[model samples]
Target chain A: MSGITRDTLMAFVDGHLDPTGRTEVEAFLAANPEVAAEVALLQRQNDAIRTLYAPAGAEPIPVRLSVDRIAHSGRRRNNRFLTQAAAAVVLVGVGLAGGWLLRGNADTPGIADRLIADAVSAHTVYVLEKRHAVEVGGDEEEHLSSWLSNRLQTNLAMPDLTASGLTFLGGRLLPAPDVPGGKAAQLMYEDANGERLTLYITPRPGIDAPRTELASLGADTALFWSDDMLTCTITAPYSADKLEAIASAVFAQLNPSGDGYEI
Target chain B: MADILHEIEDAVPALRRYARALTRDVDRADDLVQDCLERAISRRRLFRPTGQVRPWLFTILVNLYRNSLRGQRRSGDTIDLSSIPEPAVPPAQPGHLALAELARAIDTLPPEQKEALLLVTLEGLAYKEAADILAIPLGTLMSRLGRARATLKTLTGAPAEPHLRTVK
Candidate 1:
């Protein structure tokens, strides 16, 4: 009873005291009506607080607050910043390379050249956008894969570029006036240096197009590869070798049948 | 890595609950939770995989809430305590405290005391754990809780008086 203090009374009310401490407090409270009433009021206050707000924990969580989604978006933002410096250097180098490569083939402007132009153009415009870079974010990969596959009329598996230090930012559907289904899917990816790569994919163009072409134009490199079922133009600021490396990883995943361009 | 995320995910409901109590507004509470989750997940590489995620998350939430309050103060936007919506009344039960009055009193408590009291009472955290989350000594935490409770007791005097004997 001599050990009983205001702190002990509060611990008793909050259920934080040990059993012996609790027994001591209980016996002490039995002897003191005023202190007992105070403890009871504190306990009631705790109950009232819980009653007012505990339902929030039981309510359905909004999707924006999902741990996985926040984690995924956070990764994307970090990727954007980490690569920003390296991407700047690479972009300047590729921009110089891209200028000459496109001029030599401009006279005829074949399907391969046209698709590469569209792919490169899309890449240049979107990579600079801080927001609105993609129609759906990469967190919705499953929905994106299925929706894109349906829209393009071909199976489109979002390639795992994490192996290549690339994070998928997501995809948007675009008009492909030069290809069948008149639709194209642009899948954007970002490297750690904040440099962006875009895959401009369309169902194999009905007219004859080159099986493969590598073109470097103004700060962007476009590597075009076509199989019987689909054509993909990969545009990024990376070198021909780097693009080739990513291309194979993308090719294997995009066309798992293993019949496409052998790296 | 996956384990840490799963741990973080498991703590979301409690984080939301604590945030709800702190902000007393649905959208602001969730926005706070989202910001906390993003920060926790982004900086998780710095977090030891072996540490419990709940206290870490509570620490982040508490810091973010404090920073936001400071930002609002610097911007000269005073929080209108009167603007806090009335709490949803639970059905009356014998010995139930007045919910709205208690909420108002809690809103008016000094931030540190309110935080210490809620961590101990509402979240049911162990006293040490609550103290650690607040980054205060156990003695300091106890004092804050005492002050917070005594203030609440005084503020809710009328509703709580029926059962108490007059000290005189």
Candidate 2:
């Protein structure tokens, strides 16, 4: 009580001092005028701060800021992410199925299998529709090539298959995470009967396998071949011989130099 | 569970008051409270059933506010000093005028001092509770409160009466 420190005085002002200590401080304050005045000013400041902003607490709480609403919204967001993840898995499964159908019994397809799977699945979904088949049609081949090449992050030339009784029907970009660039470009072709075929091409660097493989899964036959530069998977319902002939034409046209084209 | 929500609902006004005083911004204060409540509700299973939820919620709110301040600092965003509204000039009452000056002075303090001052003064929290919420030692909390008051005294100007008359 005799030695009233600043901490003790602050404790008194803040109501932290116990009753016995409070009585002691009160006695000290009675004896000390300057200290008591300071404490009073401190208390008033606290009062003023409260008066200025305390009304905010009394105002009605907005729904968006409510605890219940925030929790509910968080739950909804988590549910949506889970749904999207599930859809991705299903899409991958469909892509794998398409690969298996096209390359019936190829020894080992590697990344080409994946591209074929994705391309066939995309073709199956979009080819059935007469309209909305491609974002950029075959009529705009130069634009499609540049746009798809930019998106897929590589140089892509639209392969001419007119000699194989198929005409360019256009190309679409597909997500191909398993591939090197996380993207694939599928160029579609249509014959006189409106029968369709697709070439799934992606930049290939890390893939270590043979250059030629043919497999048939269901309705589609796929011929997968790769050189040092790129890998292409030709997926169609055509027989293996027919697909190989179309693939040779596609290979020569896609790589016009003939240096990268085998057979 | 319903009882807990109801208790939190009852404490919301007080929490908002404390948060607004802590943040000095309406939207930021509410965001802090919302984050605190969501964390509390989700982690209720870990909460001791017998423990009071009020102090826990306050702890969470304070931590979130501190984290946000740290983030803002890293991003190099200027602290918004202008957002704190100036206190209205009260009618000719001596205490009211002093209080208005005090409010502006509080806004000028370092964040730690301001936080300590509000917890003890505005929220009327016990020294121990305030220290616990701030994660500071009791001695540190007392010192901060002491420094805050001293700063306010200087900024708000000396009181009218110079002497303390002994009351019977």
Chain A: TM-score in each model: 0.59, 0.56
* lDDT of candidate 1 over A1-263, digit per residue (tens): 56777777778888988899988888888988877877777888888888888888898989998988876541322222213322433554434423443443435456776677667656776778879999989999999989999999898889999999999999999877778788999999999889999999999898877566666554566678887889998989876556767887888788777543111
Q: Pick the candidate with the highest DockQ.
A: 1
Interface RMSD of 2: 17.7
- Scored against the true structure, residue A174 in model 2 reaches a CA lDDT of 76
Best by TM-score: 1
- Please give the distance, in angstroms, between residue B124's alpha carbon in candidate 2 and its true position after superposition: 0.4
lDDT by residue for model 2 (A76-157), tens: 1122222322243355464455444334443433455455456556656667778877777999999999998898777788
Instruction: Report the interface RMSD that candidate 1 achieves against the true structure, in angstroms.
Output: 11.2
Clashes per model (N, Cα, C within 3 A) = 10, 8
**Clash pairs for candidate 1:** A83-A192, A83-A193, A83-A194, A84-A193, A94-A219, A95-A218, A95-A219, A98-A216, A98-A217, A98-A218
The 10-residue segment with the lowest total lDDT in model 2 chain A: A76-85
